[model samples]
Target: MSPGLQLLLHDASGEWSSAQYTFDQIAGLLMRRTTSKAQDETVAVAGLLGVDVARLLNETGQDARMRAFLLQVETVPAAMVLANAPARLSFPGFRWAPRSFGGIEEEFVRSAGVATCTADGLITRRELTILSFPKVFVSNSETSSPDRIYLHLPESGSLYAMPDLRKLGGEGVHEIDAVIIFPSAPETPLVARQPVVVVSTVNAAPGQDAEEPLECVYRFRAYLGNWSDRFRPSQMYPEMFDRPPGEVFITAQRWSRRVMIT
Candidate 1:
């Protein structure tokens, strides 16, 4: 295990009286009991409307991006890969507001009308937990890499790294193995660390669960990359789009592992 990962596990296993749960309890709480009501509705609509999930998504635009993307995918959080792409590029459907990653998180909390969520309530709002230099990778293959991308926060003048493959040999190169520390987290902020970058999110429709509570089957991780222009994808790569969402999500889950403890 990388020191960073070990540090995060140590932090996670620390004895904080607040926002803590046993691994089993965490599993129990996160486990799905019945099918999601939203999923049920989507399937029903797709059947009655005589359109497949993919078709419905293609026909629609930003207004329904989140739901539509989730419906069409054949996998889990991996669906967020495509769903997150638009946001990564600052696309309208996913951008928190008018081409930005900030404030979108607060939108979810307010829309949910939740002052606090979960038992301990540290999860004040739904925000994309940005992971830079991610470690403790788990996936089907030993060489698998989580799509740990990054974003630049012009407002704060921060340069975030998304475990950038483009910067494998850069100077002052930092690799965080076991732990992730978020210095600027809003709800439950961890001590901020340097080599920090910016924001990322699920970048889906806003105020989704405004009516009632929701079962958060998946949490999206967005990386507002802060790499120099040279060390970045010259253009969005088509190859990255072809892989299974589940596989990508498995990698992402591990990448986001440390941050999700809250």
Candidate 2:
């Protein structure tokens, strides 16, 4: 428990009656006062606010205090969506967010950070840049890696690890159509070979008016290769020799009105 919070609670009816704490302040408290473990930090927040840790852990729904602590902060709270993430929240708007950051492993890659929350604690929407693949084949065990996913440029056979794909969907590799989205723009200047991180994917094409929302799966790092660099199968993948690379363009598109984190 934090001394500031303890004082605030102790003086709730006195000088601190109308006192308020910013998200930064609370988040700072969590980092400084609690251990590095995410579960302990979560529980410490709940305990400070008099919330039942057991209930918060057991129930997937959001707790009022916890929601306020998470969303009311100055900056947007981020939820890591990679495999082996420490914790995951079942709250309606936070389905794509990690429940706790206590035991996060090194494999965690990307997070769903672009989102807005309603005043009433509902997550209204999440925004991300999406790239849909016309052709995608799952990598096999022999070729696949626990920390990386081998990928060729559209029609090109060369492979690179710009956006590292570590522990994407756990240890197993599976087949599915990729609807890749970048949660945030690259830190560097926008260029032909822009950096892109995979946020979510869908097995089938959900038309613009499809009733069902896209369920967010795994996230990894990859790149939008420059069209000029023609990838040749002779370089890496002989099977891809027949398919010549095409001109790939980077455009902004809205793929999720609402997103689900799995």
Candidate 3:
């Protein structure tokens, strides 16, 4: 261990840790001092997490930020957890599905470093574009609101907490890294909404043509935030930007109006 660096040790829960590493033993895989077993339990707990943790710490090579994060992660939750869900499947035939569902337009806007939606903004009726479900059947309602649409990324169509490549390139829509649902409102909200849900994806980049996803979907993440009407902010929602070429999207119905996107 370098005299400058003190190894950090903590459990997965980010609870119960030790940081008493001496200057001499800091240069090892898992630092343990002959003078005490203070780091023993920490090592056992972290060891159960797998060798990956050790590798990450080693690869990070004493990066203070990552080390701090690992030691006090409970205080600062990971911006995103790569695999949290064990059920949902990923995009099997992404582009072959409805192009309207893919948020390529949003991606194009974001890659340019522009905000697609926001905590607040004036979105003209057409500015907040929507599409039809290609089918019509909602209770006994005779009139279907043009703003009304149906979006379904079946579990089979969604890549949940797993590492599998799913093709997201096809005609019409160029690239799609993720599928999200925004709970806004029936009409253009003059204000903000509460409890925004976001899902971000890390899929293979587009292949030769737009039809192939060069890589398989390896990871994705989810986030929940306070009220918001503007496009997903990369700052507030790092998960939204931690993805491939495609960007974040809102695929569900808006559920609020004029509250405040705090």
* Model 2 per-residue lDDT tens digits across residues 1-262: 5323442433744554434554324444433232544445555565444445664455333343344445533134332333233444545554444454434443222344433443322222454434444433333233443233334443423343322233333333543334344343346322455444354354535465455445545443345443334544454443433432321112222344454434
lDDT winner between candidates 2 and 3: 2
Task: Write the residue-wise lDDT of candidate 3 on 48-149 in tens digits.
Answer: 322234433443222322332233222111111111222222224111111111111111111111111111211111122111112221221223211112
Error of 2 at 97 (Å): 3.8
> What is the lDDT for 150 in model 1?
36
lDDT score at residue 262, model 3, on the 0-100 scale: 9
Ranking by TM-score: 2, 1, 3
Candidate 2: regions farther than 4 A off: 1-15, 18-39, 47-54, 57-96, 102-126, 134-140, 144-170, 183-207, 210-212, 219-258
Which candidate tops lDDT? Answer: 2
Q: Candidate 3 lDDT (Cα, whole model)?
A: 0.24
Worst 10 residues of 3 by lDDT: 107-116
Which window of 10 residues has the lowest lDDT sum in candidate 2? 244-253
